[model samples]
Target: MDFKLTDEQVKLRKEFYDVCKDLEKRKPHGFAGLESIYDTDEGWEYHLYCAREYAKKGWISIGWPPEYGGKGTIGDKVFFAEARGYYDLPGIDIFGPEMLAPTLLGVGNEELNKRFLPGIASGEVQWCELWSEPNAGSDLASLTTSAVRKGNEYIINGQKIWSTGAHRAHWAFALVRTDPHAPKKQMGITFILFDMRTPGVTVKPLYYMDRAHVYNEVFLDDVHVPVENVVGQENEGWRVTQLLAGFERSSLGAIMMMLRQLEELVRYCNETKVGGKLLAHDPLIRNRLAQMACEIEALRCLGYRIADAQERNEMAGFEASGVHILASELQERLSWLGADILGPYGQVKRSRWSPFDGWYEKWYQQSFVLFIAMGTNEIQRNIISWYGLGLPRMK
Candidate 1:
């Protein structure tokens, strides 16, 4: 359980940082967050450009098997993520390499792997998750979206809500009901993938309060998907769903983003004077900043622990939930602190008067998304209690 990076890992870490730093310099002004890839034409092009750059280095498949274009270990993947987070770079699609690739490696058949892995590794295809339905978010097993087999294809008809970047995705991995007669709701479910451009598929914008089009409502009306697109086995998608969830929650990128923001805030406080005194000199500000630093460090350590577990091929299950809860809550706190530090200017966005290009303003408005996305913090707590603490589930 040594936390130190080996000499080679240290060199690889430096390489990641050096490349990301150069990329950061070329980033368009106002380029922030994954939503940028979907909200503006320039942003989307820039995202694709960065993706190609990383793909050329074989970085998108860093943690995959060598046959699939992968050449690095899981630890290398972690370092790359940290570098991207610290620099606020966006090239890797979280739905693709971060979640689906590993899941495919673990459960997909040879045909499925050979067909899809190459596209993802090459960064030639982007993906979205169509998991949540209007009435089936937290209780996803209750989803009623059906995919009935018809010859060699499954005819899909349903709706998916809160699908992030759906309008920009080339393909989507989704959960659907393939069997209505199964004894349990979870038993009837299936995991499948299909092209977004498939006939009968439609995507509509679901704008944020700030009018950002980062999410969408995706509709399927007899969308034809090849039966071969199914991941793992039909009528047992809940297990696949659970497996992907582990990767989703084990992300360390957000934590590194917070660290960068914290560093920026510290610099601002040290240089800016308020009431004829440095903000850093204010005891109250110092106390809050110090507290956030410590919390962020704790989360970083926890992330490393989870990554270590993953390297050992162990199920991080509840540990991933723990990281999710802490990281999301910490972000909320950090955003609030930023707003407080900036006062009224914090509320401004994309304006000359706003500080830090109003990044904090937008962040404060959207920080609550993580509380509900992927899964709710309340649900995460239940996972921690039930799995980590060995507590009984209340019937």
Candidate 2:
């Protein structure tokens, strides 16, 4: 593949970067991590403002089908992601555009698509995932959340833990057990969407170590959802779940964020001296940084390949898992390296002595989340082994 961009793509890239750079200038102080969107009112308002700006430009719908208001190709989507990642912008809601929209485009009924796509494209609707439960995170098939059909609606009941941004989400896409008696555990699951303000739904915060309110525990007690809200066939949501999982894995935005952070770290090393020696001149630091740069570049290439495959409507099953593993582990490694370079200063959070406005400290605490989120790295490795390597399952 020729890595060079076309003339049109080059122009689009420049426009995306220019707009994001301007937005970056106006962003709130300490708006560093994804959690900031839900952790504070200022961050949340900034996120809404950015989303509205992107919506007006049709940036949020760039990758959608033209009939659904999309006006660009997958490459355009990649460029937009790169811009957002580099600038650490939060206009786009990951659960909505990044995950659910593509899945809906692939498997949803015509009515569902027509009804939901506009809300997402306009950036008026924010979404959250309600998949993980206290007992069914990694082994998601074991989830006990129930959704029983009753005429034109389904009654849902159960709890979902570790739901990111649930407290602020306008809607949610979730998996529930529609048939507990199916012969196989995964066979009985169903995918459904519902309003967050449903009478029986409740959301409570699960504050992080940094006291950030990004994650939540959502409880559904006899919540009612229309049967038409079910995506694909009932009891076959596992297929939809797997399809959405592919979209969740290739995180180009995250790779871009790490790239920006890497550049900042390099600048710090060049300008800051320790014990009369420039940190950049240290052989060990230079070697580590070089290795990280190589890994990040390779991951970026992998991301581009995935986007190309998606453009062609091909499924990148094991390759998506590979991206997930590399991206998550690379982030963890990069954060560890940042902590090492910053030493004692890295531990300080939002204080006068903290470097990069305490970004490294927050990053160090949150880097571990990617490993566990969107399926654990250990599970991703098993996927690579089974699908990529054609290895037999271990019973």
Candidate 3:
């Protein structure tokens, strides 16, 4: 496959990189320079304000179509890579514009697209995915959340766990069962978006081991939504969900965060010494670093390959699944390497003697959560086995 980017794509990517450079240069000092500065509500408020200002400056549309107030720039992988390389941005909630945009643009009604796409692309609105019900995770089609149609509205009632960023998001794109008697488990599902501020919608904070409120439990209690919010045909949401999950898995931007963490690991290893020598000088640590670098390069190429397939309108079924699985695993491994480099400090969360500005201190604590987010590695492997390899069901 050719590794060349077109002239226009190259130009747009360079422009994106330039903008990120400016954002990085102008970013606030203190805790803002950290990987995830917006862990707190107050910190997020400031981050959102920055995001809004960045949006107004047209700094938020690398993956959206032009008709939806975006630059309609293609070659999203190139643009995202350039942005991450230029700016130290932690890549939070990037799926909203990249993964969710494609799903909405492809299947959403004209009205729905027109109403939400612009705001979404502009960073005026934030969206969270309400997937992973208690009983249904990897087997997402087995979801039991119910959305019954009545007049021009659908009343939804269900509980969604591990809804990332729902506490800060303005809306949610969720899957619900609109048909109880559908022939197949996947047949009754529908994809819909609803306001998080609606009555009967309860948001319960779920704290991680590090005492960070990142994930949430969202309860929908007979919440009413306009029928227009539904994407594609009723009871066909499973297909849309499949496509969306593919987008999420295939996205190249997720690895950028890992890339940043890798840089931090190198710096920490070099600065922290053991046995009167730098940790980076150790053979085992050096080998681990070399392995991480190689894996990251491979993952980067895989991401670009997915993007190339997307540009050619090819279905990247198992490749995307494998990429997602590999990326998350590499992230966890890198975090473990960080903890190892820190030694006893690996387990510490808050202290005056932490290294890497206490970044690894936090990552060492929250590394497990990375494996389970979006979808677990087990789910990803199942997708590859069943969908990619055409494996037989166990039962």
Task: Give candidate 1's error at residue 219 in angstroms.
Answer: 1.0
Stretches of candidate 2 above 4 Å error? 248-250
TM-score winner between candidates 1 and 3: 1
The TM-score-based order of candidates, best leading, equals 1, 2, 3
Tell me which of candidates 2 and 3 scores higher on lDDT.
Answer: 2
Which residues of candidate 1, in runs, are more than 4 Å off? Answer: 248-250
Q: lDDT value for candidate 1?
A: 0.89
Q: For residues 12-49, what per-residue lDDT tens digits would candidate 2 score against the true structure?
A: 99999999999999889889877889999899999989
In model 2, what are the clashing residue pairs, if there are any?
Answer: none
lDDT of 3 by residue, 262-312 (tens): 787888777877889998889998999988988898888887777767667
Q: How far is each candidate from the true structure, as Cα RMSD in Å?
A: 1.2, 1.3, 2.9
Q: 293 in model 3: Cα distance from truth in Å?
A: 1.6
Quote each prediction's TM-score: 0.97, 0.97, 0.88
- Candidate ranking (lDDT, best to worst): 2, 1, 3
Candidate scoring better on lDDT of 1 and 3: 1
Clashes of each: 0, 0, 0
Position 75, candidate 2: lDDT:
82
Leading candidate by TM-score: 1
lDDT (C-alpha, whole model) for all candidates: 0.89, 0.90, 0.73
